[model samples]
Target: MSENTADVTETATEGQQQPIELPADHPLVKTLAAQKESIKELKVRAARADELEDAQKTESEKTADRIAKAESEAASVPSKVADALRTHLVALHGIEAEDAELFLTANDPELLQKQVDRLVGQSGKRKKSNFVPREGNTSTAGASDERSFVRDFFSGN
Candidate 1:
């Protein structure tokens, strides 16, 4: 079995490709080396294309980019102001922190302030209740005895 395995291994090695060697001055070898250098130059140029293009941008193009950034920040101003207002009311005016969402959507600041004032005013008042006081016997032993007595009477005990 070992001799057969050796023969199989020799056959496999004989079937594999051997590396081709060429002289340094050969035309094919020179052409391949030049192509490799060209590929490296192409990869570097591709990586730098976007940055080089930005550096060469015209004044108007740079201005347009700045304007776009400013517009995005301007669009967020109202919401940012609302958030600051919500935080101020909750921290300084005694509004429940969880209820700040209501103030965020109020169209009129005065109306929101009025609502907050009312809420804070009522916060100090006693909580009203519809609960009424009542009294009743709570013992269960007498009921249990009654039930047992009725059961024994029925069974003729």
Candidate 2:
């Protein structure tokens, strides 16, 4: 027997012994074939959609990485500027460099300058008292007869 004929005959005998026949032009068979073709097309489209989605996701991740890097760089800029201004403050003021942090309260350049100037002006005022004592007061109590209260007090007499 032909392979196709044997397959149909065997399947029919194993079942109800009734032949399964349908005209190719039957509405139900046409509809089933159309559905199968639609399923194949849908599977192809689904695979293409997955590929497109993966490409889009990859692009989005790269964009996100760039944005994160840019944000980090932007954040560090203010910190670097503040450190530079603090170093300037420390050099100009001749005070501890750590004290410069207090003056970093403002981000505005004009305001920072104003605060630095104010600190410098205030520190400059203190310089007057740092001058050396009079030469007469330089001697010790028992060494010189200068005998002034200021001299005695400075010499620890």
Candidate 3:
């Protein structure tokens, strides 16, 4: 017999006939036939994975940027409220613009008003002394002294 027939007979005697013909038209067979095509398919899969990773990275960066911007805006709100209070005080008090600005910037108005009221109540019960009245006609010397005292007291000088 021929060599091919002899090998087939030997394989048949071994209880199995494993077919070795290449089916060039079969989808799986065709895929395995071209090494360059297989490599190209693998590269395409790798590129898809890289694209997914880069998309996730860009999304995370946008989320982080939004969070940072929100935090910055939230931090400025209190300062904006404080500035509004200062402007209101300057407009309402008929005070020296600088003095109103300083008072609003330096102290809580509600707390300062409570303290001043308490001091005024205490002064009403006491006899007049060197302390200048909040509203009264006074000598020029007395006015200068009171101004100097107020300036020195506020400045801690």
Clashes of each: 0, 0, 0
Candidate 3 lDDT by residue in tens digits, 72-116 = 998887676656665665555444555444443434546545544
Which run of 10 residues does model 3 get worst, by summed lDDT? 100-109
Least accurate stretch of 10 residues (summed lDDT) in model 2?
138-147
lDDT for each residue of candidate 1 in 1-157, tens digit (9 for 90 to 100): 4665576677678996544455688778899999999999999998799789999999999999999999999888766765566568878976665666654355455655676677676775756766666546455565777788887899997
Give the runs in model 2 whose Cα sits over 4 Å from its true position: 1-56, 97-111, 126-157
Candidate 2 structure quality by residue, lDDT tens digits, 9-113: 789778866655667887778999999999999999999998987677877787997999999999888667866776677687786555566655666556777
Q: Is candidate 2 or 3 superior in TM-score?
A: 2
TM for every model, in the order presented, reads 0.39, 0.36, 0.32
lDDT for predicted candidate 3 compared with the true structure: 0.66
RMSD of each: 16.0, 19.1, 23.9
List residue ranges in candidate 1 displaced over 4 A. Answer: 1-47, 102-157
Q: Pick the candidate with the highest TM-score.
A: 1
Q: Which stretches of candidate 3 lie over 4 Å from their true place?
A: 1-57, 106-157
Ranking by TM-score: 1, 2, 3
Task: Tell me how many residue pairs clash in candidate 3.
Answer: 0
Distance from true position, residue 78, model 1, in Å? 2.3
